[model samples]
Target: MFKPDGNYPLQLHGFLRDQNKIWTLSRENYEALKNVQTHTFDVEGNVVKVQFNPARMTSTSAKVDAASISTRRCFLCRENRPPEQNDFHLDEDFYVLVNPYPIFPEHFTIPLKEHLPQLIEGRIMELVRITSELTDEYVVFYNGPKCGASAPDHFHFQAGNKDFLPVFEKGGIKKEKSIWTKSLFSAEVSGIDDGLRKYILIESGSPESITAVFTHFDQAYRDFRDDDTEPLYNLVCARDGDNFRLLVLLREKHRPSYYFAEGLGQILLSPASVDVCGVCITPRQEDFYKVKEEIIKEIFNEVFISSDQLKKLEEII
Candidate 1:
């Protein structure tokens, strides 16, 4: 159902597009989202309200008691072992499991077996190296913990048949460089663009190119982010003849639990089932455009762990 005026409540704004969800935010609501602020807005005749809740950063929504970790059945570690029916082994520490809700017929996940923290470092390099060696025609990617990884506790990566991600197929890679001499490149994705940040398309035909891209990004990661932190991100790399198309996403956060609780989240982000398989469900248009923004705010509020937990995560990272 479209908002009567095609606008969101003032407190909720911005759109989130995944394979199943695409949402638009009202300009007024988008403006209310400062680091710590609460605002209300009109939704049709009713006033639907939203707030930037920082309790997540200040408090623990649910305790991660000792039992949680030991009892944790990490799919990347347990169910993925020995390779499921639609899956195959990629390497010793990594395996390719078919995306249960495939956005494309041959979508797969290349997840690491260990319950390592999901961050770009030595582990990601290994994943990039392996994927490069395995095939020249696949798209390989990683969605950072705050970006799209629902299983933030497990370290894994994903891939899909080249045609699934239109953003990659449609754009061409362009080289870039930071002031510090770190080299990088990007391709533009049309549907979404944040003028302040440059989103680009990318591809890797050789391990060297993949390595270069990852290495450069890793360096940029180090350069752009605080030495003590990570900026949420997502990636897509495709092959185009002798070259490749890649999409690198530097994002702010993930969708909220409501997106997952309601299936419509998937329909809005049509074209990418990754979120469906990983987190929320999106079944239709309103869910995509309306609920996505509300949930994003919710996700931001919910996942902001306490300083103690953040410190622990930092120590491990």
Candidate 2:
């Protein structure tokens, strides 16, 4: 199903008539076709149609066996096979490829040539610099392996524009004064507030300010753990006129409970820890509706608090 090269299924041509255009389908038309069938088991030993595609998604257990391994042989990094021939190519130190299963029409990913996990190094700064200068309207983000990265073997980041995701369309922090605020979600768990009191911007519109901010945050993180590994870090920096707002998150020890809620009778359609907690791009209405709020809350619990760590967190909360 995945065709990293531009030569994807011919059916995709029907799905995407033109690559340049955004929001190709109207809301009504999009909603109508997004409906797909889901099957669930009933107590009476029969199958039931509990929810429609646009309603909720039936949770299924994730194949965590392969992902749990400490060591992985990354084909992307090793150049065993690259993304697509025409669509992407190797730059000086990175390989550029258009995301084959892009949520946004023209989504692209720039991955490191080596399989190093440490992104706080100078390499990330170079990537941000290149993207900011070349990308049309896209915003780039990094997902730490433990945070939400599906492919933890190779270090890579995601890029998409504001038109694709509703959450990034407008910004100024969700609220004017609250440390924790919510937007995009009608419910409370749609978003939760967590933060790093300090941040350093490595580069920005003004090279000088970028240098200052980067120095500040980097040193703080190093100081946080003189001998221990700091939590996996995720950060999003957006261009706003002459300045930028850098959103940074430090991964913690707790994993959420909703992650294990898969396969329940009811459709618990929440996205994984990455999509809900981090930047998730959903192209279809089905994904939005089917992804249940309860499921998302459970995922949050799992990401931040593992079963073993839950009791310990209870004492602090």
Candidate 3:
């Protein structure tokens, strides 16, 4: 039975108390959080924070090929979950659980009830609602399957403590470029094309308007990809007061060839949604120490749509 007067975060707190294993991992996270190495890089004037965390090696080094993924059992599914793991049911089809390998002060992984492929079709608003419910404290983000998701077979969204990302800390847009239209026929849109990174910020005080804008933007992105399915992108949605703010980062590729390069030149790093949006993750100690600003700029250039292509998409939108 669904608990009538319960909150998901509070429920997770209780579960952590009862589940010693998860509780211990959560405690370990506190220690890892302290040891995290931080470096600030200036990319042609825009700043990005680079973090070296040894604990993230699993995600950074994970092989996401179809055969590798198929050989392994799904971890997010209830039947495959750890015996000590517990979750708070958000509804009939989703559950909220503490992320053991956390990247934030407090993190969560919300997975669908059914086993499904990692596709974001028809689910943009759920990202809005989750961010709305966790407003002011958490930011809900979606990672495209080919972009960063290790479990690309399972549909999910990650919630992390707010203000940790450099994009949020930067506050309002800087050096705003006038490339994309600020209005999509009816709804309001803001474009931050400072050349540092192309961003399409959509805002609406009402969910209905927000939904329409997101749908329209998604359709534009799909058309740009020239396909009938999910396009490559990273989305971060946050709700404030009566307004919903959605930031879309368009992508062109998954990982650069440098990632697969031979030793000394090879830096074992994989740029994900989080990585692309200014908080690059370095899972290995050596790479973290050796990574440079020019390298960071190159990675962004490789993963993101070129300025020329971005302008083309803007014209199309």
Better of 1 and 3 by lDDT: 3
Which residue pairs in candidate 3 collide? Answer: none
How would you order the candidates by lDDT, starting with the best?
Answer: 3, 1, 2
Error of 2 at 271 (Å): 6.7
Q: Which stretches of candidate 1 lie over 4 Å from their true place?
A: 1-71, 79-87, 133-137, 171-197, 200-206, 256-281, 284-317
- Which regions of candidate 2 are displaced past 4 Å? 1-72, 82-90, 178-204, 225-227, 253-255, 265-317
With candidate 1 superimposed using the best TM-score fit, by how many Å does residue 109's alpha carbon deviate from the native?
1.7
Q: Score each candidate by Cα lDDT.
A: 0.42, 0.40, 0.75
**Candidate 2 lDDT, 248-310, residue by residue in tens:** 544453233433335543333333222432333233344435544444344344444233332
| Candidate 1 per-residue lDDT over residues 1-317, each given as its tens digit | 11123221110111111211221221222232233332333221122223232222211122224355457565666654433233344556875554443333344567776668777666544654544443444567777665655456778787755443333333222233211122233322221222112343334444355556655555655554555466655665544445544455544434434434645433222111233222232333244345434443344344332223322322221
User: What CA root-mean-square deviation does each model show from the true structure?
Assistant: 15.7, 11.4, 3.0
Model 3 RMSD vs true structure: 3.0
Q: Considering summed lDDT, which 10 consecutive residues are worst modelled in model 3?
A: 1-10
TM-score per candidate, in order? 0.51, 0.56, 0.90
lDDT of 2 at 260: 32
